[model samples]
Target chain A: MEKVDCIIVGGGLAGLSAAYGLASEGLEVMVVERGDYSGAKNVTGGRLYLSPIRDIYPELWESAPFERPVTRELVTLMGDGASTTIELASDRFATAPHQSYTVLRARLDQWLADQVMEKGGMVITKNRVDEILMEGDKVIGIRAGGDDIGADVTIIAEGVLGLLSSKVGLREQPTARDHALGYKEILELPSSVIQDRWHLNEGEGAAHLFMGEVTKGMMGGGFLYTNKDSISLGIVVGMEAMRERTEKVESHTLLDAFKELPHIRPLVEGGTLVEYSAHAIPEGGIAKVPKLFGDGYLMVGDAAGLALNALLTVRGMDFAIASGFYAARAVADAKNRGDCSAAGLAQYEQSLRSSFVLKDLETAKEIPHIMENPRLFTHYPQAVSGLLEKLYTIGPHPSQKLSSTVIGGVRKDFMNARTLKELLAMRKI
Target chain B: MDIVVSVKTNLDLQMIRIKNREPVLEAIPYKTGDLDKNAVEAALQLRDAVGESKVIVLTVAESNRKVRETIKEVLAMGADEAVLIVDPALESTDQAGVARTLAAALQKIGSYDLVLFGEGSSDDYSGQVGPRVAELLGVPQIGYARQITAGGAGVLVERSMDEYIETLEAPLPAVLTVVSEINEPRIPSLMNIMKAGKKPTEEWSLADLGLDPAAVASSCETLSNLAEEQDRKHIMLEGGAAEQAAGLVNALLKEGIVGR
Candidate 1:
């Protein structure tokens, strides 16, 4: 039997990160993946928060196949035939370190996996781990294809469907309610066209978030992210909400509603669909984190339920990278001591709790409940869209000020007393 | 020439979540383990190289139901007959134990031209089994084979190593672990999926193999507790794009992916 310092499961962002970290420490590590390639089965909104990746792969931007750095952000409120947007643009993020960037997961994951292999780590792809090989209560190795591959420590970076995580007792049974499903389509558009339409520079990108009628009163949001030559557009809906309303609606209907939104139509007009992908995300927030470490093992990234504080933002990729870093640290420390056990690996949990991942998830736990209010997904966006439409439209009669129009629209959608209560509740939540 | 392809299923990590001090997982409805993609692909390639009529797909798992379904999919993708070892007691067996079980089954089946498997599975990711099973069966095994070719009763395979690749020539009935760097796996066609349903999936129980549970090695190592969490912080960039870009670049430099 061959023994390694550590074995990491899953070859996506988290597992690759752990492998990279462990290999950098001169420890022998092996990473196993079930996919044809690291990102073959992965699907995401396509935007990566730049901070965590920058911290782990500092000069990666120089040669990495990044789509583009985000230079503009748009928040839109949608109505039947009208929409209002809050646009923010700053020329600040164009240099070395970026605020955020976009990438196709398939390509980025493959590159990151290469980095792990380049650092003297072993990468075994298209392998599925069958079971955990144990010595008493301790995990000593993993079983695949009827053979045991021993390791001092095992880090599970398997993405959302962490089957082994639960089997190993790091996680329990996850219900659909604690998760969310997202379906996306990538639209091919020329660079110049994207630059002209989204008002971006040669290598810049834009991100747009849609709320209200797009989800059709469901508890979710829609997003559009510009890539090098394409746009990633998708909608994420709460699994529980989807289940609750399943009999009455279908995803295609919701998709059609989203596509029919006036502002969305023009943005995607004439674009050709190049790819379609769907994936499930763990949105259970901080309260949902499973056991992060146990005897001889640690969990990182989506396997540990690392998501951003708010569903509106891009978070998982950065969190996955960061957690993978910590898992590697814990394993390295354990390897130095020649020990891989529950107690020896406890530092992985401690380090993770101390990182920005747990804190963000904990903070964002309230956002979901706040978003549960019907008005947030229904009345509020409609009210804002109507007010914007009134502002932009010409009138022949004596003018009504923007303030009055906004007040009138707000009143039409919500009573003053109720609106005040909702605002207060939103603040408290 | 019949072929045996080993496949194993793993937890779908995409639906996995850490909740209430536990890692929660949901059972996958139906999908072969990712590595099996390579095995099926390799078999189809060999079949295409030789003849589809000669290739066979096989798997050994505690649960033959899923294995049978998976084999059918493999057949649809291009394989022939399939063999499944359906022993309930082997469900939680370790790698060595599984290897022994599969070897015993292979011995009973006898006369396989080639044996193929994925480098490792995604969930547990143990890369030892193919070689171990080969050891048990006393056959030459090739690890991390990115490309394989059958010629003159021997197989030519490109074995991918940490930093280099080696082309190895092995005799017939060799065990090969496929790497993702190999050819892309072909998706099963609609007609193939339908035809896979008709492929013969031979089921064998421990009783069929005349094996005793006590005879096999058993190591019950259980993973029961894991505690780690992620903390996310959104530091809204204070300055405009240029400032944020500089800060981002500095952060990247700290991470060490780029040169100063």
Candidate 2:
């Protein structure tokens, strides 16, 4: 039987990070990935907030494959035919250990896995782990293709689906209500065109988010992040809300509708579509965080529901990296004490709680519930656009007072005491 | 019995992007040709049928990191070992040059009862390498074998021809090319992928195979390889649903795309 000190299932950021940490510390580690390469199956919004990862590998920013630094942020609220946008660009976002950078996971994860291998870790791709090998309620190894490979401890970072995690009873099967389905397209354009379209300097990019009519009143929104020479555009909708939708709208139909919007069409005009991908995001927040440790096992990343959907910004990769970092530290401590039991692995939860991961999740735990409010998707955006139209439209006719016109439009559509109350409640989170 | 399977690393055509009416081939992902996977599967199946056999995978390409990665994929697919012939001089080699390099590699391997290849590669569907290699090696060649079976001291192949299928018998030490319909390629399990890393893979240059670069130089030169831009009529039919459907039918009839 082939044996290793640790076995990591899934080769995304979380699994690769743990493997790199353990291997760098002179531990035997192997990562088994199901994709042709590390990030072939990974999809994200997607941007990596570099602070958490920089804390783990300080020199990574110099050599890591990053698309562009996001120096501009834009958020748009779309009504039936109009949009109100807020754009922010600052030099403060471009400094060292910068805010965030857009990443193509297919490139970033592969480079990370290569880093793990360069550190003397083993990474096997294009192979799926069938089951977690267990001996009397403790994970001992992994079984794939009628062969058993032993390990002292196994870490499951199998993304949102968490197939192996659930099979090993470390997590519950995620339901549609707890997840959001996302579809993305990578559109190819010249770098100069992208720069001109988004008003970006040499190596700077923009991250844009859209809500309201983009989702057609569904509980989700759209995102567009500029890569080096391509634009990643997609829509993410709540699965429960999608299931409740009266119209049988396909996800691609939503994306196409979004592309046809006057505000979005020009940004992507003349760009050739290069790739389309779809994935599910864990949206249940901390409420859905699964059991973090078991006998001879631990869970991290989306497998443990570490994604945060704060409406304006959705973050998973950063939390994934942070959790992987802390999980490795806990596992290393357990190894030093010569104990690989559930009690020994309890330090992982403690570390996560003391770190920003669980703290941030706990603070914003109500954001997901607030995002489920239908008025945020339907009424408020239309009212805002209507108020803007009333204020801006001028003709030969007599004009009413601006305040009265705005109040009349808001009262007619969505702005009322009840909605104001809900908005205030959402802000408290 | 022993078998030599010829594989080619070609740009994934599905992932190719066009820019300025030209294929943007730089940094495009490379993989074993889609049909070449069927050839490898056929070789592995034959190895199993022969009771005891070794499958040797061979590829001739410009030596680079991508070629090495592509070789590991086939090795993981169950090839016992592999021979990679990479040289900068072979960068622009044509089908004839590829056939010569493969023939020389087969000669260097000393002995093999059979040779296998895909009917055509994805990048250049020239369908010439297998027959050319057979001619160079002076062996009987079978093309487009849809089904193969082992027999006493020989093999029976069901050849797929344009008009009709023909059954042909070839003795040991012959070459055969297979179509995608032959068999489904197996995805290597995790254990197989792990073991593939430990498998013996040897790198050989033209000099290692006792072949002079000048002798096997490519004769055919490519003049132009450009992306074909498709032109479409941007006609809009403005009316109600039924009227728009009628308008589309009329337009199709005017273009002779549909019969009345």
DockQ of 2: 0.26
Q: DockQ values for all predictions?
A: 0.02, 0.26
- Chain B TM, every candidate: 0.83, 0.90
Query: How do the residues A79-156 of candidate 1 rate in per-residue lDDT, one tens digit apiece?
Result: 656777888887676665687889898778878876876676766666777887767667777877555777778888
lDDT of model 2 at residue B45? Answer: 89
Query: Model 2 compared with the native: what TM-score?
Result: 0.80
Per-residue CA lDDT of candidate 1, range B94-212, in tens?
A: 78877887788788888787888889877778887889989988889999998888875588998999999899999977889998878788865333443465577688887788877
Q: Against the true structure, candidate 1 has what lDDT?
A: 0.78
